[model samples]
Target: MATFVIVGAGLAGAKAAQTLREEGFDGEVVLIGAEEERPYERPPLSKGYLQGRSEREKIFVHPPYWYADQEIDLRLGVTVTGIALDAHEVALDDGSRMSYDKLLITTGASPRTLPGQAYTLRTVADSEALKAGFAAGGRVVIIGAGWIGLESAAAAREAGCEVTVVEPAPTPLHRVLGPELGEVFAHVHRRHGVDLRLGVSAEEVEADGVRLGTGERLPADLVVAGVGAAPNVNLAREAGLEVGDGILTDAALRTSHPDVYAAGDVAESYHPLYGRRLRVEHWANALNGGPAAARSMLGQEVVYDRVPYFYTDQFDLGMEFSGDTRGYDQVVIRGEELEFIAYWLREGRVIAGMNVNVWDVVDDIQRLIRSGGPLPPQD
Candidate 1:
């Protein structure tokens, strides 16, 4: 029987393992992970999990017994130290070696750290720590005005704590949502009593507060760093696989090395829809990429192509988005009030859409994209 070894027990690793079994692969599958806990959803770590509204059990992607029943050897708390490609074996930190006929690297990205007094929200432990700190109730200073920082600020506000978000950019989410939507986000945050600071950089951070570029120190009880993330490509690089911003792969998710594959946040695959190499760090990507990679590995010759989609729920708002926003020509708005939808157009077609508390038309918008129809003019 072929032995398949997969590293990192995150969404990508778990989903890939499940796919292997579902495809009737009667091989010995071993999954290695650095984290002690079972695979859980990471998106919730910054939102519902941080708000204390979600239980630990509710966050698990699958039950604990699921792996055993599927005949998957899940080695939790085991870290991979090295790989010998010539022998097709992986060395573990615990001084054990495992040989594999095929290998999959799904090691996900880690949160970018700050120089001083910085907290991140990438893991469940990180969220637990942040939650405990928020329960104390005081001024919190957050660096970076990206989605993670904004979501953390919203959670802090719900806990009745004063929050201040600092970003060097001219506006929040300007690069991703463009100026108009960025401005709307800034307004919404300010209306919620959040001190949104834009075009200001944090020169230094201390336990007591944060120092701005203007040499002004803002008092803070807790400081969180949500600048962004860097792909975990060290292993792939060490194995002599082509690595750029991430592991470079083809449309079928095969790495430069034959008999080796990668997927999820760690794999930078060719995106047919975007016409370029892209790395996505969303939950949907991990879930979708895993099965696609597995099928490719099984010689099914399937090309991984899907419209990028993700969602975020915060402060009674349900936000859903699809497609890339890099080259959108215009944005069309539908409906009125707080509940509405926004469609981003590119080359006279609906490239992306976002709905905020207006899910009634989500199906319609998806159908329009499937039909390749032009988005309505912005009014």
Candidate 2:
């Protein structure tokens, strides 16, 4: 039987393994992960799990016995220290080597840490620590105004902590949502009693809290860092594979190296729609990209052209967005009773859509993007 080696046991690695089996590869599949725990869903870590609405067991992507039943050799807590591309083997931290005919690098990303006693939410342990800190919080300082930072702030506020968000940008999500929608987010957060500080950089983080560059010190019992994430591309780079913002891959998700592939947050693959390279970190990308990469590895010529989609649940609001908003010419808003959807049009085509408290229109908007049509006007 052929041997396949997969590094990382996150969503991408797990899904790729399952896909290989489903495709009847019948190969010696070995999955190595640095984390001791089994693969679990991460989206809930910031929302449901943080709020105590979901149990630990419920967050798992698969049951413990599922790997054994699938005949997968899951080596948890085993980190791949090095890769020998010429030898087609991976060096483990335990001084063991695993050989493979094909390799999949799905190491994913690590949270960017800030100075001082602050925590970044990327793993189950991170969430656990944050939850414990939140339970005993007086004032919480969040360093960033991105999606994760905002979500953490909302959760902290709901836990009865005085939350303060500090961002160097002019407004929250200014780079992603632009200044317009970012203002709406700032308003929402402020309305919920959050101290939304924009255009201010955190000069330093101390035992007491965060100090702004403007000589303002925000007191805090706990500090949460949601700055950003850096892709884990060290292994791929060491293996002589091309690495840019992430592991550079073709449209088929194949790396520059032969018979090696990458996917999920770690892979920067060519996007058919945008005609450029993109590294997406959303749940939809992880779930869909895995199968697409697997099929490509199995010699099926396929291009992953799905619209990037993600949803954020902030308090009572359900915010869903699809497609890229990079070059949109205009935004069209459709407002109803308690439901609103915004469509981003670029050159008469719907490039992206954002829905706030409107769940029903999300699918239709995505379909409209897939089908291609003249976008509706903004009210």
| Candidate topping lDDT | 2
- lDDT value for model 2: 0.87
Instruction: Estimate, for each residue in 323-364, the C-alpha lDDT of model 1 and write its tens digit.
Output: 778888888877665678888888788877888887766676
| Per-residue lDDT of model 2, residues 1-379, tens digit only | 7898889888888998899899998879898889999988789899999988889999887899999999999999999989888898999998988888988888999999986888899999999988888888799999999989998988899888899999999899887877767777888889899998899999999999899999989988899899999999999898789999999998899999878999999999999777899999888888888878877878888788888999998876779989888888877777853368878788888888889896777778888777666755642
Clashing pairs for predicted structure model 1, backbone only: none
Q: Output the lDDT of residue 81, model 2.
A: 89
**Candidate 2: deviation at residue 153, Å?**
0.7
Each candidate structure's TM-score, on Cα atoms with residue i matched to residue i, is 0.96, 0.96
Stretches of candidate 2 off by over 4 Å are 336-338, 371-379
lDDT, candidate 1, residue 122?
Answer: 91
Which 10 successive residues of model 2 have the least lDDT summed? 370-379
